[model samples]
Target chain A: MTDNEQRMARAGDYVLGLMSEEERDRAEHDMERDAAFRDAVLTAAQHFHKLDLTTAPEPVPDQLWQKVSERIASLPQMQAAETAPASPSKPRVAANARPKRFGLHSLGGRGGFAIAASLAAACAIGYFGALATVTNPQPVVVVVLDTPANTPGAIFEAFADDSVRIVPLEEFTVPAGQTMQVWTLYDKAVGPVSLGTIGAKATEVRLQGPHLPLPKPEQLYEITLEPSPGSPTGKPTGPILVKGFARQPARS
Target chain B: MDATSDDDLCTALLVRVARGDRASLGELFAREAGRLIAVARRILRRSDLAEEAVQDAFVAVWQRASTYDGARGSARAWLTTIVRNRALNMLRDGARLDYVDDDMLEHFGERSADAEAAYAALPDREALKQCLGQLDASRRRSILLAYVVGFTHGEIAADLKAPVGTVKAWIRRGMIALQECLS
Candidate 1:
């Protein structure tokens, strides 16, 4: 087949879930960087979904919608009224604007977002050895935050003192004039409370809040861009960049 | 409502969802969740994983509704695309579809009489049925197996008792033919 036909066919394979990891990664990267490739993938997706006709409907679990609504509540606020394709640009936060704090209203019912434990997700924890207490070693929990496409974004570690250490593993940068604020949601009923402002240039930082309780299992950590200094509203008002669930470390 | 009206309702609900309307989301969920779950379950094979995929897709819809342009496609198709991708990703990340038992693969690919009847009943799916019918049995089976079962080229080859290269060629050519025929 010719190159165009080959590319279209490859797009078909991608939508069909037939590509290997390496091939998939290359195609995904193209989808990210190449608009034409993105269109090809979209077309392939549009066509491939028609095959759903072959399968019969299975009974849906009762609580599935509840679970989904909760997850949506936990996500970062919608970027804008118009949905924009994810571009190479970093998330931007408006300056001098009162950042909107996450509220529980948008979430349906009382069942807020569930950060179910994904302990099996391979995550590397880098603890500052000097800070490790020899007499009372505290369990350090690490969560590798990923993009919707499953690409690793950052490593978030919560300590015994409720303090969180944010480390950049892959490309994550807050544009100049904007600050990246971290937040956590402890309860499904409660909204995400701000942790603190992180430096744009800083690769790693330990965030400590005296009033906040220690980190617990199933707590979600997310990063959102906001105006300088921090969100005036004490909540995230910008797009969520990366997020992950903190699961209890596997017992030794 | 007719299918076109149903599509319009979905689009309107998506607009409300984009505006942070929770009730509209609930309405949309009530309407489409079952169908979306069925689609995901078929690809992921595990009910729990399928639910997870469908859940993620709805959450995505809530967040990404503003991105939907009516000029491009129907809202139902957009929703299905999200759930389908989510389900396929789960399978890939978990390596759930990497290995398939030969006996199970045989059963999975077999088209039941009931399934044929069901396919014929859906008028909206007639074009797809006709397009799929035009391919030879192997190519059709390869396309259906890959789409419905989330099978990789190697897996399909193993099930078809063919070489991997030959299977890949068949899938690629088959897809091209389908695209051309559909267009």
Candidate 2:
């Protein structure tokens, strides 16, 4: 077989979890640019896919299955266990339920665009001069915050107290009926408590954290646009307008 | 333990599950446990390890049910992929697939040496077996090496001591035959 054919066959194996970690990575990369190669891989994958997954994954012994059922049935959130594929039937979330981004889950293909526009509006309002300074006797130092990659967005300054003020990197216009809810999460939590909500063209966000013991690692700060009364669920139910994670500066 | 694929029962169980109903989750499990655990065994190659893997996988599904995306693949594919990945990792982390403990070893059956034991032994395994049986041994072996052991085509070719071309043909022919058989 040609290198191309061999590569295509390898991609099928990778999808099947047959390849080792390294080979799997390589196959994934090669399959990306190779359409014909991908088709061949999918062709083989469909064949293997037909193998009654029901028959291959041996049944859990009666006792063990019972134990698992008991444990799963005991959890407060048994959604995962219930969705676990058991019979030959399809799943509920299999091609019908859609995931929403923000604004009580504002739908459509442009969901991502709305989030960007909100951030842009926030940024546009900031650089055009929208910062409110409170006369606190504590020392004020400028702190740099970055998103996934450091984009020109916003900066934050904290008072001696755990409260910090967010200064936008650009001027942004937030429409009425929408508010920016802020949150700080240290670890992967199911629900993150809200910090506070900011209004339109509001450059500075004043937040008090009785819960923020310290500016811990992975302590994320995100701003989501919620409804007027804020998220009734106590979490940011809107699209994230702006977000940044604290990163330590590198010393020379 | 479950044999009936009653649609209403399945739908009712899912709705309660969405509402965080644990009892419903148990009922659903009782109905599906025999089939799913059987799947775990074939993929894991050891009943004991398969039992634990299935147990862990199910509990995880229960906790993260809301995260399921309908646009992805079928629920069966999703669940099977999870357990299959789990079992593969369980073996990949070690050098071999043998992880049977005393409890599992004690329950040994006649033909436990085969990796595809669950799928092969099942009456439901008919379609795939007929499909695969149509292919020559060399082609079937290549497909099995890839699916059963999760070996890459290169690995299959290397292990079988054949050129990559022959391995690819065997896999292609085998899959085409399968698609027809299952269809």
Candidate 3:
């Protein structure tokens, strides 16, 4: 563009998260490797590097720490169940084993906190409905909604809540052309329900459970790559990026 | 305990974190949180807001421990980058940018023992610290408060009892000058 416009960039916008939804797209549209930009970032990063954390401060609130710990503790167990062995057709090493040992049943979600989100449980056992088949229940299909990295994003407590979280594996890089979309499958339903797109890091999904109050346990969940805005087909047309079963501990 | 040594301490803590050791992570948090909060408080110019920035930063470090690459920079450098980016994201949203919570525990701790070791061999390490010392007393103070503390230009202006525009100029100039010195 103009020489003047280049200068402002030379100064680098002090603004963090330099690209917004649109800006990011535009920047990537015809992105090129520029040494000047690289130098500027390096320079800025060095200065940023100097900020001291010698005095990290007092511990954060116990509540926040508690919330984080709970989230972390539940995550490994939930991740394991979703990662449990799938059918022999897709036989791979079982990655869902406990933290360092073995124990299928857990008390808190894993052991017994009535695992609330078992979507991955269903997905992991894909087509193994018989294994998950409970005598009192109608047939249920579970889907472990995960990223390409196999990190569990959400366990659909119910399709109605439409609730979901994009669990990250490092900061994911979404290429310029495609966006991530979440979907769900029910036996009678036409196809996966769109949960919407998310950022590279964790993002909260707004559920539109207009029809259902929340996704029932054992429902199938999946994420797929679609066009910039999203898929016009209204169903996942691209390769299914992540799919999983839902297993939630029964409410006692 | 100075910035150089601080970076060293961060690296040691990160090594422990990568091993999935929660206790060491907590220890690191206990040591670095306050300074992080203090800088954040200055940058946001609101104590509560700054504290949130620090908390989010630490939580992320715990979750993404595997991604930290020591080859790129020190642990302190990597972490400061995380904290700064998160804080800036919050600012960009133009939210209240003020900390708010009941009985929010502030982080506290001292310069790391590792930092002391790193500090010993630092040649021209003081270049950055010394450059910061050279600014006009007021300009230098404002820049240091903002640079080290993460205070925004506006917050620095208020703290130094100067105009926002003036604070902005000092930061811009200070950073530019600081850049020159570092290079």
TM-score per candidate for chain A alone:
0.44, 0.38, 0.36
Model 3 bad stretches (over 4 Å):
A1-40, A47-56, A59-64, A74-78, A81-252, B1-9, B15-24, B44-51, B91-94, B97-125, B136-142, B145-170
**Candidate No. with top lDDT:** 1
Report residue B70 deviation for candidate 1 (angstroms): 3.0
The CAPRI class of candidate 3 is: incorrect
Q: Which fraction of the native contacts appears in each prediction?
A: 0.35, 0.27, 0.14
Output the lDDT of residue B115, model 2.
Answer: 34
- lDDT digits (tens) for residues A31-126 of candidate 1: 544556566666666655555644555676777778876776665554352266543222232231211112322232222111100110111000
Better-scoring candidate (DockQ), 1 or 3: 1
| Ranking 2 against 3 by lDDT, winner | 2
Q: How displaced is residue A237 in candidate 1, in Å?
A: 43
Ordered list by TM-score, greatest first: 1, 2, 3
Model 3, A179: alpha-carbon shift in Å?
54
DockQ of each: 0.20, 0.14, 0.10
> Least lDDT summed over 10 consecutive residues: which range in candidate 2 chain B?
B66-75
